[model samples]
Target: MNACIVLCLALTAFLANAVAQYETCVADTAIVTGGTPGVTVSIGRDEANEMVQITLVGPSDVWFGHGFDGLVMANNYGFIVDTSGVSERRFGTGYSVPTELATTSIVGTPETSIVGGDRTVVIERPYSATDA
Candidate 1:
């Protein structure tokens, strides 16, 4: 009887962990840089279901925060970029919220910055079936 009870408890724990899994995945090559060393940074796609989360990571400088000011999230596709400080940084996936599937391709290019240590800016967007 004790062995059976233990087995049931183990099964329940496994099921609980499975249910708590996050639906997002980090992209393989999400970071992109621009001219100079710390002028522009971008992250491509961090997808989960039909939603993609992108983030811009950068160092602590005045110029860094200025680059990623007018960032936008698209239902189709978009980008966030940052480049303002001394430290070399990148943009990539952070976390994502759920979103509906996108019908058309949307494009955006917004920039922002972070001071102090390094920072990451995030945006979640949707995509079509083919593009995903």
Candidate 2:
């Protein structure tokens, strides 16, 4: 098993305002059959800024992230945040640390905090970034 291996996601996109400081409403709900408890991944669109905000919450001892627009880790553009509130916009290429693309422009900073033994990382980036 690989990424999203232990944790499964049931993605749903809603084009409406979300509750509690979200720009747009979209989430990956947990399935009762076999889902990772106390884990969540939520995506919201910041229409005013033309960006997307990803909010992830999970165990405070490990790192977590979300990737999109590709098939495999190496093919995707993603943000990975460690437990200490450090994050990177990485273009994965292997099992080791990923490298950021030279032509890509990552916007804003990733924020992470641990409370109640849960780590929450929030990242914002351009909705459609240029590779050139």
Candidate 3:
């Protein structure tokens, strides 16, 4: 009976993962040019929790963020790299606002790193019904 229970648990885990993989949607890759040449951004979403994942690859020591409603405006979340090569997540509102740290409805860890001469950042957050 113990062996059977273990097998069932393993199968259950496998099935759950399979279902999650099937519900994932990947957006088209976006190419960005300018200060950080060859920069590419890709976004993906999973139906389970409407979680969105953003991946960015660009030149090292560059900052990147996703702006909603406009460029560098409110509802923007991104990562900034200081001169010492340390990266930190930052949330801000647009200049038109009161110039304060904007609140975010996103839920997850946003991180950035420099690897192989490329800067990579991955951010994940669930979709808020009020976001739209």
lDDT of each residue in 6-89, candidate 3, tens digit only = 999999999987753323354434433333445666777776767777666766755543334434445554444333432323
For candidate 2, write residues 1-132 as lDDT tens digits. Answer: 554643443222232233234465768543222434776778888677677777778778777665566655675666566655644556646775676566545555677778998888777667777651
Question: How well does candidate 1 score on lDDT at residue 61?
Answer: 45
Question: Evaluated with TM-score, which candidate comes out highest?
Answer: 2
Model 1 C-alpha lDDT per residue in residues 12-122, reported as the tens digit of each score = 999986642234443423233432344333335423345444554555443332222224222223332335312212222344542322442333333334566656554
The ten-residue window of minimal lDDT in model 3 covers 81-90
**Candidate 2 residue pairs in clash (backbone atoms < 3 Å):** none
User: What stretches of model 2 exceed 4 Å from their correct place?
Assistant: 1-22, 28-38, 92-97, 101-106
lDDT, candidate 3, at 123: 59
How many clashes show up per model?
Answer: 10, 0, 0
Q: Scored by Cα lDDT, where does model 1 land?
A: 0.40
For model 1, the superposed segments whose C-alpha errors exceed 4 Å read: 1-48, 63-116, 128-132
Of 1 and 2, the candidate ahead on lDDT is 2
Q: State the lDDT at 47 in candidate 2.
A: 72
